[model samples]
Target: MCSHIFNERNRSFSGREVIMINTDAEGIVVDRPNRFLCIVNITKPVTMESEMVHVHDPGRLEDILYPGNRVLLKRAAEGKRKTKWDLIAGDIMGEWVLVNSSWHRKISEWVIQNKIIPFLNGIDTVIPEKKFGDSRLDFLLMEKEKSIWVEVKGCTLARGSVALFPDAPTIRGRRHLEELIKARNEGHEAVVLILVFRQEAESFSANKVIDPDFALTFSKAIDAGVKVFPLCFSYEENTIHFRSLLPVFQKS
Candidate 1:
């Protein structure tokens, strides 16, 4: 098992320890044809012209995917691929926010493996995408005989200093919350781990205005003993790393 421990002695040029990430190149958004593809002007390949890139995030990122917005892209591995670049992160309000949903699972897995998240430490085994009921959960952590079901969500929508999830309405997200509640009721530890891809967030809340059903379901999940953990992180250029955990408002 690979474990990462934060060292105060090691620091980067910005006075923060360099957090390793998976992105390779930088680009400026030219246009987003749809949710899956975006046209960007590459900065690393010396490409003065705009090129179409793949966007893995399914959410409607109106706030971050604006024209001229700085974006981080991962170059596709040498082979036949749909697009040469994959849009992963974006600069919003001067901070780099992770826009890719694919990283949500990996980041949460890293935290769990490193035992960085409070109350979820000492995991003996970590399993990804485990089946529980009708849905596939993000992780199933085993510690001795005790098991925990974890669902991870990437939060990119922020209003001022407050971070919110599901910028758009998501019936799927609400269903996941219901499953978490079910797992909790069956004598297993259930958790919804929210990864806020911003640094300035003071607290975490469900976007009730956008999806009232999700908000209500989230509250019900909490009432049924489902734990919700929201943690903040920041990225600059190519490095991405954890910052700290934020206060969770299940009712908000």
Candidate 2:
């Protein structure tokens, strides 16, 4: 049952515990020049100077990525890329919320590989970024003769007791939902995995006020037999811990 997955910070798969992510450094937010770049003051490992860091996630992040907030960083090898560090998570209300989209694929793979969600237990192989009907879905899971088309979405916005996705309006998100419905109609199992990084969220829903089209499409996809999983996790002490499987609610 899914109830056992809600009991612990880390679970063992055949006696092997999973550490989803690890960071080599910490930083304080100096400024955000754009959606993909942030000026950070490296506070750990003897680097007191300001440097340009890569922000992987494309959300507006207006609520969390503000100046003076403490954040976690994953350092890149010297001279490997334009930015030396990548913004991993941000401190929000004394809790760390994973904001990096680069880690979304890895997190989704871990959940599927470990069979944390009972319905997805037997997924054998995860193929990512496959083009189907002009939409590049995040993953295509294969198990025996079963083909599952999956789209992964990272959600960081939490309000009161609910978690809403697409902190900004996303035409692309709406398109993904439409494609998932198409996949379902084509005799394939389709799923949308909403990874809610906020631990306090008791339920998940599509943000209708921000983008009503996406919200309506989400309900449409639900009616088309496409499954949605709003899995919650907490980022604390530099490790991601499973919190719970949130109930999906259509916000009216």
Candidate 3:
């Protein structure tokens, strides 16, 4: 298996070693009245003062999005929609954790294209949003005549060195695992690629406390030959640095 991917750079100028996704305006979060909208005090990059920013992550980010927390925002296009900015990342425990779902595809594609993962090093082509049965997975990797179906999940909740997914209950996430099991049954290599945005996360596991059903289905999928890779990353100053591959939690 591949160990940690690090180079000769600190956490700030870090991701020049990896993918450098950009973010513009900075803000201090005020409140999240609903799931998709957050009121923030835009402090930099043409300060707009108070504004409604679109939140892309669905996870319950009480720890990061609380009042007065620093965040990164990407300004929406001129006259694009109602919301002027998008919440991209938040400062959590001294690390910038990427909470944006929009970057998941770019990060995953970069990792795949660069042949970072050992098992996926042989991938020749990557097809996005491919349909498999009734489900549309994130990517379909083609290597020779073999097919590999992948579903990507962005994880933001972590405690100490352990990372847990779906800070809130997710029936849809459970269904995704079921579809992965079905793909495995059909003799296709199925995988759930978890992007752990928490920089300190050394391992990943299902949030059984939040959604027991998802945790149960997660185990079932693993038992049914679905591979899971909980990879660690950190978002720092408009760039994302690949950290390491975390293992699944196995209870004794």
Off by over 4 Å in 3: 1-16, 45-47
Candidate 3 colliding pairs: none
Q: What does the lDDT read for residue 63 in candidate 3? A: 87
Error of 1 at 6 (Å): 23
lDDT-superior candidate, 1 or 3: 3
Question: Per-residue lDDT tens digits of candidate 2, residues 1-252?
Answer: 112112123332332333557797888888999999999888887676688889999898987888888888888767858898888899888899999988888788888887777778888788999998989999898889999999999999988988998799999999999999999999999988888988788878889888888989988998898888888888877677766677787744
Candidate 2 residue pairs that clash:
none
Candidate 1 residue-wise lDDT, 1-252, digit = tens? 322222112222222333466777778999998999899998865665578888888788989888899888887777888788788888887778888876677678777876666567778888998999988988999988889999999898988888998888998888889888989889999888888887888678888989998988987887798877777778865666777767765443
Best by TM-score: 3
